[model samples]
Target chain A: MSYITGPDVVKYACSCGLLKPISHLYFCRYCFQLRCSFCVCHEVDSNFCGKCSENIPSSEARVKKNRCGNCYVCPSCQQELSTRIASKGPVNPEDSKSTPKKMYYLSCQFCRWSSRDVGIPDQSTVTGGWPERENVHSNRLQELVDMYKAIVLAQKQQKDKDKKKQRGKFLSYTDRTGVTAAALRKRIGLPAEFTHPILKNKPKEPEPASAKTEVDEVPEQLLTEPINLMEITTVEQRLLQPEAQPVTVDKLFPVHKQLSIKRSLRCRHCEHNVSKPEYNPSSVKFKIQLFAYYHIPEIRIVTVEPLRAGKQCELIVKFTNPTQHQTTIAFLKLNMDEEDASLDSEVAEVIQDLDQTLSLQEKQQMSLTSLPLSTSQPSSLISVPSRQPSLTIEPRKISQEVNCDIEVPTSSFILPPRDDAAEYDDSGDTHNIQDDPKLVKWRKSNKAFIKLNVTPMSDLALNSEVVCGFIMQHIYTNTVASKEPQKYNHKVKVFLRLGQLVGSE
Target chain B: MSRNNIKILPGALVCEESKLRGDITIGSGTIVHPSATIIAEAGPIIIGECCLIEEQVKIIHRLPFDQQNKENTTPVLIIGSHNVFEVDCTVESPKIGNNNVFESKCYVGNKVTVSNGCIIGAGCRVTEEQILKENIIIFGSKCQMREGLDRPGLQTLQMETLSKMIPNYHHIKKPNKKV
Candidate 1:
């Protein structure tokens, strides 16, 4: 016999007629139908840490009280204390300085609360924990419990009355049907089929005369109930009692304890011995093992020069990939304030093109040219003039198939001579000789354009070598243009380099 | 109504000197107090009972700017029950919720979410689509909070330090799990 699979299940509308995905739809066990967030009542059952077995509800987790039923705080400083394992021996070799017994330290930095003041034997050890305080007055406890029950019953009665008043105002059609059926049965001298069992047992009663007035004044009905002192006593007693406290051991420590081998290596050439550094390679190894396969691309600004208003400048961005797998750089877009038009248009074009190409490897260098400048300066930029120009690079999209190398050229340019005097000198006789001296200077500067050629690096990791060429051109043309045309040229080369470690094993 | 006969709903707490205009439906256990003005200019202000409207609470369904035109009316202020509106609270837009609390001097702008069991602290201003989670407590004055509580403490200095150590640490810290 062949097994037959049904057609792909179409997510029909919920019982409440809400069209949602199968994932969004939840099976209402009570209603036996699909329910969405809107249809069913969402009641938080418990607030529990998935790792630990500790759980507490929102009402019990009061900020002012600061006492969780399962967690203990140092009474003095209110810092959460953890449980530690300890051996019972005066001179246990395992409990020596080299191998100290595990102890819980409930120390608060704010108030310096320590667990030592709580009279627990060995503050560091979990043995002889804080003594449990028990109430010897059993009779009082029983009386208080009885009083609480009575208060609850009275409160419930008041609530029922208020609900009845509200229900009376509704005037449902079922009530009319019930009345008509009862009257017809009485006229025919037959039993009423629809009459409820509970109602059948009760004698017929006349309707209240002030039913309308009662319904109208439902809100006031709740306030008429008298407060019971017995209920308050139980509530106060519960609030005053110290809550139960539990110990929490860090789970990570147990997993890390198994791999606690401390190994050291020495280099013979330098006659230098390398002990275990503060930054353990094993820890880095563990992180790599955990997240190397699933790493996301991150873009950051390595360095930025002086931000020019309404002028174009180059930005050097450094991209780092900690994962083993290579990441393709699809597009590196920037989000500037909408008001800044200088970089908007030019940067958009450059990013759009870069997005089409560029696939960067793990720990690779990629640099792009022609970064757009922001026309309108940010308020912070204007106030802090000395601050370097910063650009936020957002990798718009990422891919794995396509990759392109980013070439950042580092070079300086010298402006060419700007002279139109020699060519127009032959026609000087026909033209006005008293031309504005400023006008002549203006024409000279306009004719000049800077040229630059970058020297590519053979080894990208060479830090001592100059990777970028910068030139600040000061045009001394005595031009009478409406505004002085001041231009600046700066170039930057972005590449990845291994940072130095003070001490490494 | 007699002073003793004024039924204060389960969660409803009203502050002093508050004036309520027109027919307002407060749900069970709702409280409203002195000096707070809940005005239903165009439509009724239906607040689910059990909501706590703290001292000096001001809920205006219609903007004072819209009063110029007779035809153009304001939206109704529909608040759900079990909400705590703290002292000096001002809600402009109609907000709906249960078990939510707005701390002192909170300014909830137009069209925001004060979701279930959220505690908004004193002097906070919510302007955008701020979706607070259940049992979430925001403490501070004038926070530009955003939607999605999954990324808690993203804009804080602590997160910045982590980002400095490991680039894109937030993306790696927790798996993308949506509640």
Candidate 2:
């Protein structure tokens, strides 16, 4: 349970400069940059019912107002309602020919709310055929909509006519020939001017509605009787049906379950998918998942000594390499400006060129997915797909304050690649590598516990939390963009909250 | 510690591996699984018919610190009919009503009184001193309570299957009294 609700002690700084745990950040392989939800573009991949896991086509979803047709939720509790069969007794118990049809009703398991509570009759078929309520003012609302449309069309027509009249900088043939059209019309005995025929088909305005003098007053029966508050619906219950906002419980109706969508996250800078789920709704696997945890070394605090202001404290943290290739980790000053200028430009340019040729195979696989849309929709009504301009968010400054200083280790450590079989084997360590005994506390397969000396600033107040940060630079191997893997140093800032400062020793 | 004074009614299935202490009565048709601990430390515990006490469930009747010195009163823990104490759940409630389900890994403290049709959901810990209203369903990690319209369905089929399956695998403690 602490995996989800626990306090995040270890955080990695994203390329966008927000501090988040490794799982929440996405790794964009194309740009080799960390992207969080704030920096990524989320697009709906498919629409599906969460309860039934049935994928609904985008066009069908639009027609149904983005609601699942077969699934429903309880009006009282807003939980998925299951269809339960009610087997009624046969009309004639002894008669051989008599049979009873099974009736089905929607019921919520959590609150045990049945459709019969709201007077909805059971259906003979399993699929829902629940009665729908029609809005009383729909016709009047449609007429008002048409009136507004006609008014806007008439205004547009007048503006077009005015624009045509303004465009006569040069004279016409009739004027250049020393005879104006009006004077020539009298000579030829023609009509004064032919009005633009297209302008005659003008939109007509509807009659304006007048307000009624009388308003709805409270009924006489309400004043005489005490209201039972239990029988009335609460504000949350009423708001569930915004169209009706039923005040009484008896008027409650089963609501169609809203359709859920699976979204794919794309890096806004490069327009490449960072995380994409499989097309099947039931499949829990992802087609493209570039999580930072898969590519970067994970760090967790193991133990720390008592913290005092102006004193050096020993802090131990465990580092684990998750990738299949061995990587060397080095500690550097937590300054991003110096590192950004000296690193990554040449390697990034090399990768970007290789990505063009390497992405040809994946581009075809991604382009073949076309959701079949029914052709009955008119060509004009179907919205044409237009290219959306890619958006890039400016990187923000890191917000965490480091109140403690860390002594950067001069020597770097090498972490072996992850081995699945080593977890089950009971054999002792076989790999021989020289290590700095003062820095390395312990070592195992793909994991090591390292020690560091941290000193809290002298001016910090007693009982104030002390946080320390450092830069962890690791060699990242990129094998996807080329046949031969190219290695580049990837630097990430890490922060650790080293408890609170106590009294001075 | 007091001696074991267990009275198993006819047709009650009590496995030999279960740990039952002090004065206790197992009602007819009740199935006590192996390793279920029923420690009646304060007073007698009377369990009703068709109760399913599964493996690793601890039904303890522990008296409070002040009540241990008093001689006049010994609070009896009474569990009602058709109640299900699922696996690894600890129930020390003073009173439990009929058709209640204590789901797996939940802890019901001694001060809480579980009323009829109450469901203490899986992994929930209810330690407060309050009487749960009828048909109250407490679920989720936060123990959010809602009033269910009706009681949860009984585990009749599960009990029937267990009755037929358990006797073949474990030794049964036969009922001393006849129906």
C-alpha RMSD for every candidate: 33.4, 8.9
**How accurately is candidate 2 docked according to DockQ?**
0.21
Q: Show pairs that collide, candidate 2.
A: none
List, residue by residue over A171-268, the lDDT tens digit for candidate 2. 47785798876788888999878555344664554566889999999899799999866457667768888878899877778888999898899887
Please, what are the lDDT tens digits per residue for candidate 1 over residues B1-179?
Answer: 01121223343334334566664555554445556677765566678754556557888665444343666654555776556666788877555566666768877775565566665556777766555555554544435221222211112353234335433222211212221
Provide per-model DockQ scores: 0.01, 0.21
- lDDT score, residue B77, model 2? 87
lDDT of 1 by residue, A1-505 (tens): 1121122121223333343333344432111223344443333333433222344444544431323333454332223445544444444666555554455544333222234433344545343344544446555656666666666666666678778877775775646777576677777889766655334433333333354543454566359887532122222223333242212111001000011222332221111222222233223232111111112222233333332222223344333332232222222211212232322233222122323233342002111111212232343434332222233222122111111122222332122232345356664323222323321221121121112222223333222322232211121221112133211111111122112111111
Residue B46 displacement in candidate 1 (angstroms): 1.1
**CAPRI band for model 2:** incorrect
Please name the candidate that would achieve the greatest lDDT relative to the true structure: 2
Residue A384, candidate 1: Cα error in Å is 50
For each of the candidates, give the backbone clash count: 35, 0
